[model samples]
Target: MIIALTATTQLGGIAWLIGRPFRQSLLVSLASYAVLSISAIWVAPAFGRTPLSCVPEKGGAHAGIIFCVTNRHYVTPELKSALNDIVDDLNTSFPGIQLGVLDASFPFLNDFPMLPHLSHNDGRKADLAFFYKDSDGRPLPGGTLRSPIGYFAYETGRSACPATRFDLHWDLNWLQRVWSKHELDIDRTSKLIEAATANPRIRKVFLEPHLQKRLDVNHPKVRFQGCYAARHDDHIHLQL
Candidate 1:
């Protein structure tokens, strides 16, 4: 329980430890986790981090519920501002579309290495799910993520990197078969990338090479994250 809770929510292991001696351990642990998580949201800003919205805002980007529940949605205030600005730009071009965020930095630490993502240790980094469209090319409703947690539903394409093991670049072939039949919205996704790269505060954006070619994104800051990192084909990684 400690390992599972710690891996998902950084604070949950501590809560479980605090509640373990109680008669109703599960309930105590859950309540402890809730209090800690809510407190983190308020306390994090003191350490120069702020949380993205857990729930979707009108015409704005928000992290998926999975990210929120796992306490992975904290980011620097400037990065949060840049995200809102990017959404504003997107709304100007394609009104009413909202972006879905995946994993992000945990609250209350610098360089604490958010697992699976090496660089997200700092609060400046975050992942954004690609906008998707139905088979007919119409935009899906806002907040509709291709995968439940907004990761691992890849847009199949050719890659230069060879297959390997013992790294973060996972090819979850079995899981892909079960995801919804949604197509990547090239126009909106491309625009989102453009907005991110164009933002002065956003230092870099990681995307797969094939995706860059397919989207026709030529921004200098949009670079490949290298094969050692988790595949960027599933979600766009942006950092300050």
Candidate 2:
């Protein structure tokens, strides 16, 4: 288009200098197309590009650096519908609050544990982390990475990923604690919990009961963190 404009609209006689037709001029400027396309993609976000993605297909782009998805688990059509709706709401309602989905299920089209999860055998389960805020009451850092189960909670703008996981010991896993109070940005976690519960299809939300008490989250949708299996401190288990 640029070439066509430059070769014709700007100077009609200029077409003869390159080659008669606009098509010929376009071919001559093929290299320009590559450069412009690359530049456009790079610059689009700065201008006003809202990035969206689906795991196993388009999962790289993120709304904010706030969260990282640990695994590219497959999702059911129903689960995907719920996920999209929740994300759409969160994106619009809480513009800067980026939700990180750690795991779902596989595309097997049936129920089964996706490893470490006793349940989730079906497509009705999804995992997302609590949104954190800095001490000064700012949105938590976006670069938190998802782990095998829970999420990595780190202080913003630092190389520290202070969050820890279960012990490698065979029996110690069940006795493990999810997170310490100092490691989390508690202010924003409440909002993330409410958002997960906001969805109508959400049947249950699993998190540490003590947290539920600490935040005074009276929502009936929130349930006790789990049994002797995995502690639900680092992440929220949203199930339909």
Which has the greatest lDDT?
1
lDDT of 1 by residue, 42-137 (tens): 999998899999877768879888889889999998999999999998999887777788888889778775676778887899998888889898
Worst 10 residues of 1 by lDDT: 141-150
> Considering only N, C-alpha and C atoms within 3 Å, which residue pairs clash in candidate 1?
none
Per-candidate TM-scores read 0.96, 0.54
lDDT of each: 0.87, 0.49
**Candidate 2 per-residue lDDT over residues 115-213, each given as its tens digit:** 456666565776775655444656654324333334543222211112345521122333334433334556556766676688887889876666677
